[model samples]
Target: MTHTTKNDPVRAGLDRRGFLRRAGLLAGAGTVLPLLGAAAGPTASAAGTADGDPDQLFQAGEFAAAGRIYARQLHRDPGNAHAAGQLGYIDLLSNRFTRAEHLLGRAQRLAPDDMTVRRRLADCFVRQDLLARAAPLLPAAQAEQLASVDGTPYAVDGPQATRVPFLDVDPLPQVRGAVNGGAPATFVLDTGAMGLTLTTDAAQEAGLAPVSSTAVTINGRTVTTYLGVVRTLRLGEFELHNVPVSWTDGSIMAFPDGTVTAGTLGTALFYHFLTTIDYRGRALVLRRKTPAQQRAFRAEAARTALRPQPLWLAGDHLPCTPGMLGGYGPRVAVIDSGTLDCGLNTSAANAERAGIPVDWDHPIPVNGGTATVYPATAARMSIGAAVAHDVPGTVGPTPWEGLTGFDLLGNFTHDFFKPFAVTFDYTAMHLFVG
Candidate 1:
């Protein structure tokens, strides 16, 4: 099955809207990773276990911690140019261009040929849309990605259900469905998923003939992908039409850990109905939401024990909720069952404030590159009374200064999400972490 390229698959005469994501990086398979382009832009040499090691704090999204460590390093050794340069780097990520220029300039004078200082300052200038400023600082090849466009969005709709789609969670939480009205197929119920993704094998089995192809990068190689519609996708009593889909030769955002389903029923489809994931009872509920019912549901949602948090819509229009990091950040975190542990995808500054221990020896592997994320355990994470102790997690990067607090909300695969029922109402822009 070959998919020829369609000029622009997104805007090709379908109902479309933007689905926003708060974090800059795409999360890894059951792991959190920054939606960062490459590690070539800027970096610094590592110091001791508890200092402003860019790889450790910067990549772990612990900007707050990195800032503190750098400040301490500077206080001890006022003339440490390395500390000054790193501080300048923080300013750059935070969009404080003037200050970044000042600090990096001083550090540059101190160490005339520091590539790290040069590249960071360049990236900072690029963020401000000042090509001339960045031109002198950046290499020709590196500048292109600095100006890349945003990812594409999709439109998803289904027939009004005569009966609500409620079924047992089957321990693994997979429900039987069909692709293009073919034989029954398996799909994992995942709220953290960005969209309904299908593997090439599954797409072929379903006779998902590709109409157009889109080129994307993975593992540093450009791969051509097909985009088409799943004309008649069935899930229980519901029928979905013209659901935009992508095929994968490699693993994608993937279904849960153990089972290999045909595809995932992620947020794209979830937006159309009232959804509930009941972990204790092992049940999944889906019902159409009428205007009056939506209003009533939202009013009742306020009363649920599940702590209600503000879920922002990403460029993709997915829900992002506020969550605390080690009891410190009531900040942005995407609720991803796809990610492992409560991975910290924020900045070093926010991470240091959380007081979580940093694992300096290892770097977490992202899609094509790597991040300096330290493994950490927790005292307790406050997801509004639903807390998990000693949770397995990673601290990631805080590429921008302004993004210090936002990180991925703890992944739902953790035992904590197993007790109570959870609900995410896209219309209401609210998530119930009950």
Candidate 2:
């Protein structure tokens, strides 16, 4: 849902009122690392015929409230394609891919022309890495182009340096940067994203040249995308060249909190450096690890008893780690920064294996409403050695395959802000919460 691309329009045209916002990333199957929230980030559908305060709740970011409203509506009209479709769309926004697939698929059967349901169902397939299934649902040219997307490897210029101020936007971190050496433009820092993302307006203002194309889902709408390279992207003192950038309709630029952004900074560029999100200070620090610093960190890890979680490569070239959910079993979770809630969102299998209890009592939020999200809890959940006892989470069947049989973990800031820092030491492949 979060990952996208852009260029010339592929379909006949897009009606803004019906379009969903641009978004985060394809959830890695093992850990299911898709960015789920009310932001214009990774979203689901907006097309069900049902209507009510659910629409307002979805817009208000009260996702749980919206889902409950729709679930109650479904009780009166079990065969309503609109209710089922809308519920499924919300599930997708909440990162419940399998649920989205089931609902959206049923919706499509009930209302074949519901473009929103079709697009969202395709998104469920894409999120599951079933590219073959998604390709057929999108424009042919866009599909062929996406099949060949190869971004350049990122390289940090110098030794160790950089500490830039940031603005906390709900669950996201906002920073300023120059595009093609242009004046400063605001960018949402999303770890779930892969490369640089610019709305067409921003890309044009920065003079980017398009070279590739693809169709991607944002919220519940599908749009054509062209891949281009930026000559130079200057973030504070850190200057990066040959950066892969996505250009799409200006939809991704709008944040849920009402802030308009020029683009997003994803993990593709961040992985090359050891980065830290200083929550209290609202700062972003990027530096190459020095041998001395690495040794010092190792010693500190031992002292703090910080378990070292190995960062492994996931789709879109992001690093992930094998962790335990409810301390029940091992699941590879992505270190995602673009999320709206706390704790892990798990598959039924993962939750069951860990012995987590599900009440089938919680409501899941979406783009325009909500769906069923069971409340579940874990006795203990750990990433490396960083553990949370009596962790709160949701469990049920999901559309995602999961990163090594896991979904996602924590609100990067809200849940983990108590630590001195939540650091990603890419060079050493370790995540430290201390």
Cα lDDT computed for each candidate against the true fold: 0.51, 0.55
User: Please, what is the TM-score per model?
Assistant: 0.57, 0.58
The list of candidate 2 runs beyond 4 A from truth reads 1-159, 217-220, 289-293, 296-307, 352-362, 365-380, 389-393, 397-420
Question: Could you tell me which 10 consecutive residues in candidate 1 have the lowest summed lDDT?
Answer: 13-22
Instruction: List runs of model 1 lying over 4 Å from the truth.
Output: 1-173, 250-258, 295-307, 341-348, 398-416
Candidate 2 positional error at 54, Å: 46
Q: Which candidate has the highest lDDT of all?
A: 2
Local lDDT at 384 for model 1: 62
